[model samples]
Target: MPINLLYSPECLEYREAGHPDSPERVATIADFLGQKKAGRFLLPGKCKEEDLFLVHSEEMVERVRENSLPYDPSTPNIRGIYDYALLSCGAAEEACRLAVGGETSFSLLRPPGHHAGSKRAGGFCYFNSMAVAVKKIPGEKRIAILDIDGHHGNGTEEIFREKEGIIYVSVHQFPAFPGTGSVSFANCYNFPVYPGSSSSTYMKKFMNALSVIAGFSPDLLGISAGFDTHRTDPLLDLPLKDSDYYLMGREISSLNLDTFIVLEGGYNVKTVGNACYCFIKGIGKEKHGQETGKRI
Candidate 1:
């Protein structure tokens, strides 16, 4: 089956001036994927307010909807941000649905989530899209969320920690933004990499993370796909090359599990596009039973 990309042009309608989480992050990737003819693009609808409640508090939802919260430097309260956030969350839900239906899918929309928790929003996130999407899955199916963002998904960890039938694994930079995920606890397994780590070192940790997911034997896998780990990304210090992303994608695909990816971060607009394309290309290869050489 062709990979399905869940996206909507409306996700590009909001942005804070000079913010690293600019609209171009997803825009560039979308354009690149279109040019590459990588996959089929599916427009996503906005999620309901109740969907936000699945992982966030009613107060938090109301705060964003009413713009009643105080100004947060990281998560701004821009005009109509509530709707934009809903659209992004909706894309995640759509991607999850596609994956559950035996389709390979990616949600290429933002303001990147994974930092917002049950009661608060931060780190350029107003809603924890992955967390919300995972919670929406029906039944007692086991699920694993692999957060590959450079910064730890503190919010996602908090939401799913100790929760039944779900495990959260994050491989991110230590002593970085949010300063969490240094230790593993309960259902949350964290692998914190130091700044300026070599690509091989990062890949080693990534492989270790994949091992954790493999052990969990989840019925579904959700990837918080963040590209800010790239060497050129100004937001983080990890040194992952473009090819490293392809290797990561290929490794994830090798697991042969139903998977869905949600965009998290990648600030360098110039290279983020190519990075996404390479990752998706790697993901597409394995489905055809193609041997892409030895895994990292």
Candidate 2:
């Protein structure tokens, strides 16, 4: 089967002036993924309140609806932010749904969700969309989340750190923003890289992650794909290239997973789109481990 991708217009409402994260990232990716050659792509449906409640606490959901400040000190407040957040969460859920139903899918959602924990909403995120989808997937299955963002995926770790079935792995710049991936949580894997990391560094960490995940044998793989690791990205000091994402995508696809990729973090708009294009090409043109049943 071919890979599927999900996107929505609501993602555009998330505006951060003078910041790297912007709607241009979504527009570029969507336009590329929606191209005629890409077999499966979708404009995701709106996520319901119940779906949002799955990962976040009721209090947190209500708080976001009632009151949400700027997505952190970095970005300014935008109008109708709450509605956009709901759609982003919904789009992530749609991605998971397609992946679980035997199609690989990606959610190009922004105001990314990995940073938002069960109760808190900061770090340019208002909802824990990845967590919500992971928790709600059908069947008793183990899910592995590979977060390759420049900064730590603090919210995801906090939500699933104590759990056993979920394998949460992250490779990020240490002593950066929201530093929390260094300490090992139960079934949690982490790689805190030095300031300057390159393709070799990323590949090494990915291989290590593969070794760690081989034992876990996840039913589905959820990738928090971020471009903030790109060398040009001002967020961190990781020196990554566009081709790096192709290798990363091919490696993850080689795992033969029912993959659900969610847009996590990426600042520079130009590289983000190019990186995404390469990733999709890798997922489509590259094939490995042809045998396919339900994963895990």
Candidate 3:
């Protein structure tokens, strides 16, 4: 099965001049993936305003809707941002829906979530797209969220901190923006790696973290896929190359569980598409010593 890629042209409407989370990130990746004929391309439908309430407060939802001014420091309240945020969440919701049906899907979303919480938007995010989607999926199955963004998914962590049947794992650059996730939790495990870390170093840490996920024996896997860990990203410092993403994808695929990925953070426009393409291809590859199921 081809990877179900959920995307929408409306996502490009949430543009802010000269911002790292510019609309071009999704536009560029969507075009690149299209040219590659990478997967089953799709346009996401709209999500209800009530869906937004699943992961965000009504006050926060109204704030993004009525106030066109920037609520977060770096996240611009660009024109049409409210509609675009809902659209992005819809994309993620669609991906999760596909995953629930034993198919793998990826949501090419933005203003990248993981930074936005229940009450406010931060780090270029307005809505917790994955959170909203995860909540909508009908299941009591154990879910594991592996966030490999360069920065800790502070908002995602906070939103689901006390929730049961879910384990949140994050590997991020230490002392970075938002500055949380230093300590581990009962359900959340965080690995704060040092800056300027090599790819091999990251791989070791990631592998170790994977053991934890494996032990959790989750019925489903959700990836907060962030390519900003690449060394060239303008936002943070991590020396991961494109090959690293492929290796990470391959490793994740070894688990052989139904999985869905949501776009998180990656600012290096030049390499972001390559990184995503590599990871998708890696996850789509066959895994040995295990009977394979349809992944994408």
Taking every candidate in turn, the Cα RMSD to the unseen true structure, in Å, is 2.2, 2.9, 2.3
Model 3 TM-score on a 0 to 1 scale: 0.95
TM-scores, all models, native as reference: 0.97, 0.91, 0.95
Among these predicted structures, which one has the highest TM-score? 1
lDDT of 3 by residue, 8-90 (tens): 87777656677888777777888889999889999898688999998898888988898654455587767677888888888
CA shift of 9, model 1, Å: 1.2
lDDT of 1 at 23: 86
lDDT of each: 0.91, 0.78, 0.86
In Å, residue 87's CA in model 2 sits off its true spot by: 0.9
Q: Which tens-of-lDDT digit does each residue in 1-296 have in candidate 1?
A: 67999988788888789888888888999999999999999999998999898999998999999988677888878899899899899999999988999898999988778999999999999999998889889888999999999999999999988999999999999979999999999999999999988999999999999999999999999999999999999989999888998898889998999999999999999999999998998898787673345443
Worst 10 residues of 1 by lDDT: 287-296
Instruction: Give the clash count for each candidate.
Output: 0, 0, 1
Clashing pairs in 3: 2-296
lDDT of 2 by residue, 1-296 (tens): 56677877767866657666678877877776667355566788767888877778888777778765534664345667677887887888888988888788888877788889888887877888889888878778888998888888999988888786788998888878887777665778898887876669767987888777767888888888887888888788887887877787777777777788888887776677777777776775444335444342
lDDT of 3: 0.86
lDDT of 3 at 290: 38
